[model samples]
Target: MSMKDDLNKLNETVKQYRDELRVQMHLAQQDVRDEWDDLDEYWDKFRQKLDDIRHDADGVGQDTRETAYNLGEELKAGYERIRKRLK
Candidate 1:
């Protein structure tokens, strides 16, 4: 297979695993997953910020890099905090 095809398959595999994880999380009633899901707004914002960074890399300089990095760190921190509260 070509490199592109291989990469596409890998991407699809990763997506499938993520979907399976969501199903398992729901079945297990994992509070962390639920909280993560509820934080959709923040997640969406983060995603948009990343996309903007990619599109406008000219302005995504040092400060924007730091901001994006910190946002990701904060999100991960929040996820960890909620995870600790999980039953």
Candidate 2:
């Protein structure tokens, strides 16, 4: 093949790869968003439970506190992971 024809073929190959990469990245972003949405739902439930536990000072026990603390930590870590992925 002529040099010009080879250059054209190379450019077309690069364009195809770029388009594929764009689609893959778009799908990945959507997956991440869906995961974050699911996590947010759970995070809200955990927050409510934590608030209830805090409010019930007399009923609050070590186990309850520990559970709440652990859940909060998990949510925090999840948020950090999503944030890092977005960046």
Who wins the TM-score comparison? 2
Clashing pairs in 2: none
Query: How do the residues 1-87 of candidate 2 rate in per-residue lDDT, one tens digit apiece?
Result: 743343344334433433444444454577776766766675666666556764785687766655655555565566556655755
Worst 10 residues of 2 by lDDT: 2-11
* CA lDDT scores, all candidates in order: 0.54, 0.56
> Given candidate 1, what's the lDDT at residue 31?
65
Q: After superposition, how far is residue 43 of candidate 1 from its true place, in Å?
A: 1.5
Give stretches of model 2 more than 4 Å off: 1-28
Error of 1 at 68 (Å): 1.1
> How do the residues 1-87 of candidate 1 rate in per-residue lDDT, one tens digit apiece?
743343344334434434444554554455666666765455566556666766886766666555655555555555555544543
Question: Number of clashing residue pairs in every model?
Answer: 0, 0
Query: Which structure among the candidates has the greatest lDDT?
Result: 2
